[model samples]
Target chain A: MIPALGLIVGIALGIFLDPSVPVWLQPYLPIAVIAALDAVFGGIRAVLDGIFNDKVFVISFLSNVVVAALIVFLGDQLGVGSQLSTGVVVVLGIRIFSNVASIRRHLFHA
Target chain B: MSSTTPPPPPTDPTRQESGWSRLLEAAKPRANRKTAVATALALALGFAVATQVQATGKQGLESLRTTDLVRILDDQTSRNERLDLETRRLQATRDELVNGSSKDEAAVKAATERLNQLRILAGTVKATGPGITMTITGQPGQVTYPTLLDLVQELRDAGAEAIQIGTARVVAQSYIAEHDGALYVDNTKLTLPYTIKAVGDGDTLQAAMNFPGGIVETIRQQGAEATVTKAPSVLVDALQQPPTDRYARPVPSASPSAP
Candidate 1:
């Protein structure tokens, strides 16, 4: 419940402050967000599976965001930025779908 | 969410205790602090996600200052207008240059043709064609300058293209002079036998010479012999080096009545 309230407040603050992303950082944000969501859903799933660990969750979340941004940055330098970003999105998207499915089963048993 | 603890006896959030108290009770001090840290991390993650969503939600330029955006738009519009004007000016210049070149080409061709014809007419080039040659022989004083000039006039009227008499090319400026019962064509004195080479139509020139009241009858009356022969070809090899005009230049523009 605290986490949910925190998320809501964060969204409200975003709407109020209206912060803009820098041009240099814009390319990797969506990708980093997807990676973060993947980590969050993984943490939730781990909780449901009786394996929740705060250290693992924090480490995984950091690694996921960093690795996703690094892959896109490297791809940009190598002149394959868009294609590599698409690849990252596809993998992370599949993970999110499965985790959300698991979350649904845990929450509603449907 | 289920806890990684000893199974509670099928407990749910009831009127027994608050969620925070229950959560703290369920964990040791170390686990409790970890849970609090997790909640704070979740808050940060949520903030990051919200910012990302806002940033990507619409046009990337939405974050720019109004003044900066207006400046950029004004700059782009003026640049586009300038480019359009430049394109039109270049196209017009190209079209004018193309038309000028085409006109210059045709003018050059016509002028060259006219120059060659003028060269021939001015006796700068050799003249050749089928025509008649007239030879006049008379004892000392019979063949006079007036008779010779009249003969030239008659041949000119009959459309003689070129005429040469006794090493003298008869052009527009040529004059026949007689001094002391002697004839001179221009500065060259004529000998007894005067042969005139004329390039023209053979039959027409020959008939013109023999007509009544013509130079042939006048020469016969003058006790001189005028013999006309139609040749397959008559060549006037004399060329005139016309002096350049000192005080005359070509007019730049044609008069209104000029064809």
Candidate 2:
């Protein structure tokens, strides 16, 4: 509940304040968002399973975002930024889908 | 068996109380702190996502490299220059058309004046104007072709618009040649005494001839009697054959569509 409240507050603040992103971070923002989404889905699934660990959730969230951005940065250095971004998105998307499916099953018992 | 089961009843309440305490212990402040940390990360993630989305929505400039940005600026500058040049060319053409329409009365007057001048130059219209006439009487061989040519050149230089030597009209393409010790102007044989009539400002024409060491002096040096007289009105009756152009043709304008 606190995390949900914090997310709502953060989004509201972002909308009202309208802070600009730096140029260097532009390439990483989309990947970070996707990674964050995957972590949120996994956290929800863990909660439904009665195995939610706040430390693990926070660690996974940070790591997912950092690793995704790092892969893209490396890909850029190797002149394959777009291909690696696609690869990262595909993997994270699959994880999000599976977690969401499990959450749904746990909530609906179907 | 019933007696043995009844003996354990005394410990059931204590055991149940211990289970409840353990459950309470698990739901303690430690769990709350973890939740707080997770919430803080979530907030940061949310803020980053929202702000990034807004920035992306604003424009794609941030995603481009400095080189790409500079290239785009250069492309736009060149395009602007090309557009400006096109605008200036179009403005000149538009001004020509607009002025043509707005000054229709003045343009018509100028056109009429130009047509009269062209007709006079062509010698296709009868011209009557104040001018000078010169009669040359000399020995047959004394009045050479060069001396007559020099006299015509002097009259033209003094603004003689229309000229006639004997019966031939002196248009721009009139030819004069010497054949068999005699002068011929446009196939007309001239007599020894030649009369030259020129339509222009009489005073200027006479002054041009009388200028010291001028055409009169040059002709007199050849032992020819050259006399000049200014007349209020001199008539030129010769007409020119219309010229034909074989190679040049007019280009058709873009026509308006029929409504």
Candidate 3:
């Protein structure tokens, strides 16, 4: 419940602040968002299974974003940035679907 | 990265040997920090998501570098100016082609006789016909611009087709303006003893000039000796280039008319 409230407050702050993304970080924003989403979904699935760990969740979230951005940055240096970004998104998307499916099974029992 | 540390070996007796199964196993809840940490991460995720959406939304290109934006604007402005210049040049070329072809068609219809008449009017060729030559010897300022203008008008009225004063070929746009006691005939300065040569009916022109209270009589009243002499073949040899108009453009008219 508190996490949900924090999400709404964060959205409100973003809308009012109207923050502009820095040019240097613009290419990584979408990748980071997907990585964070994957972390959140995985954390929720862990919670449903009664195996949620605070330290593990926070560490995964941080590493997910940082690693995603790093991969894209390295790919840019190697002139394969777009392909790497696409690979990252696809992997994260599959993980999200799997975690969501687990959550659905826990909730609906189907 | 928080994953900077490697995972420990599975050594607990209660834990299973398989790695995937450990993710679903139940564990004891210890810290209140879990909810707080999740909430903060959720907030960060929400803010990033919102900002990413805004970037992709209507405010596109706002996130680009200033130099990139200026270069784009500069490229567009210069391209627009180039296109405008091209449009003007194309329009002028079109007008020239259309007008030039139509004029050529009309000129093709002008017979040899009409062509000769045009040549005479343009003063591009010599005119030889049954006409008269009149000589006027006037005082210093007696033959003013008005007197010369009246003489030319009278000759035109008497059906004098081509006329010449002194060495100047009088065309349709001819002018006589007085400048400091001398007469300027279309920018050419002429002093006394003006010889007017005209190509037309010699008898009629002589009769008109020698009429009672006419041009010759009027010139005599202005203290000038004017003589009218008829000739069978009078040659007006003064040649002048055709006048070029700068401001005036030919009015476009419909061509290919019905018979």
- Which stretches of candidate 3 lie above 4 Å from their native place? B1-31, B59-99, B102-159, B162-208, B211-259
lDDT of 1 by residue, A1-110 (tens): 55556667777777788777777777787888888878877876665554667787788877888999999989878867778989999998988888878656655566
In order, what DockQ does each candidate have? 0.15, 0.27, 0.38
Query: i-RMS, every candidate?
Result: 6.7, 12.2, 6.0
How big is the positional error of residue B23 in model 1, measured in Å on the Cα after superposition? 46
Candidate 2 local lDDT, residue B111: 80
| Total residue pair clashes for candidate 2 | 0
Chain A only: give the TM-score of model 1. Answer: 0.93
Candidate 3: CAPRI quality band: acceptable
Report how far residue A54 has shifted in candidate 3, in Å.
Answer: 1.1
Cα deviation of B10, candidate 2, in Å: 32
Let me know the TM-score candidate 3 reaches against the reference structure. 0.50
Runs with alpha carbons beyond 4 Å of true place in candidate 1: A1-89, A92-110, B1-98, B117-121, B231-233, B241-259
Off by over 4 Å in 2: B1-31, B59-61, B64-124, B128-198, B206-259
- TM-score of chain A, predicted model 2, versus the true chain A, to 2 decimals: 0.95
lDDT of 3 at B37: 86
